[model samples]
Target: MARLKTLGSRIKESAGSRVKVVSPGSWRSGMTSSQRGYGYKWQQARERYLRDNPLCVYCERNGRTTAARIVDHIVAHRGDMALFWDETNWQSLCKPCHDSVKQAEEAAGLGG
Candidate 1:
């Protein structure tokens, strides 16, 4: 399994192809200034999503009782924010389950 930093790096590489990533001290060091700002806001929104909707959305949908607290993005945060606050794109998942799901999605042409 890839580590978080490795996964994040790959994600940024794939998603930020057109955008110039430019955060000098960030894992997403290639993010541009404005995009980094947006990432900041998006992270805050993600925190809100996690706080507001704890537990795994997928597990909840399947009627499971997993302890999911990590907020997930249905799309991504490469170079857009039009849907940043849209509830349709948010989800919760436990650490292991989230890792599994993310891996599957990446394998199936989706970014985690």
Candidate 2:
């Protein structure tokens, strides 16, 4: 008699069969403003801003209370060093608010 395979084992076996391969070359990836030169100082500023303002500024403005995990610049710095380090230009925002709403607004030329 043939042995039967369990559902979990069959699923695992099928999943393990597929493999993805990529060719290594000079495929450079773009870096975000924060990753380029904002580095250590930006991290420190973000931490301090979050500590002082734990709630999402955008959500608060919209009458909702959400914890902020990102320190965003009110104005997109666009490689402007002075604007990048301007504390007054910063605001605390949640991941969703920053990535979705804020990004969309900035893309549409609605945000500074």
Candidate 3:
């Protein structure tokens, strides 16, 4: 118990020690992925984006609303933080359109 308490104190002391320190990697001493809300933040972002772009992107282009239920990436926003915040790369698409785009891209060897 004493040792655990000491470790906790050390971590608390080092809270902001490294700006580059990122979770899903660190938290070595003793912490869980869920202890921090790393996954939740992204979920929130997705919900917000879906609410904002609540129409099938392709359907909208054709002057209709298929009630897009998929949030797609015009250019997939992999782990790139720069594009993470860019709404331009994200579009709402119906499942069919999204799957079609993904499939076509994969066939063309342009999938990411």
- lDDT, model 1: 0.67
Write model 3 residue lDDT over 46-86, tens digit each, in one string: 78988988889777777877887776667755456577557
Best by TM-score: 2
lDDT of the structure predicted as candidate 3: 0.67
What is the full ranking by lDDT, best candidate first? 2, 1, 3
TM-score of 1: 0.53
Q: Per-residue lDDT of 70-100 in model 1, one digit per residue for the tens?
A: 7766776544455556678767888876779
**Which one is best on lDDT?**
2
Q: Once model 2 is optimally superposed onto the true structure by TM-score, how far is the C-alpha of residue 45 displaced, in angstroms?
A: 1.1
Checking candidate 3 for backbone clashes, the offending pairs are none
| Between candidates 1 and 3, the TM-score winner | 3
What global local distance difference test value does model 2 have?
A: 0.81
Q: Which stretch of 10 consecutive residues in model 1 shows the poorest summed lDDT?
A: 5-14
List where candidate 2 sits over 4 angstroms from the true fold.
Answer: 1-35
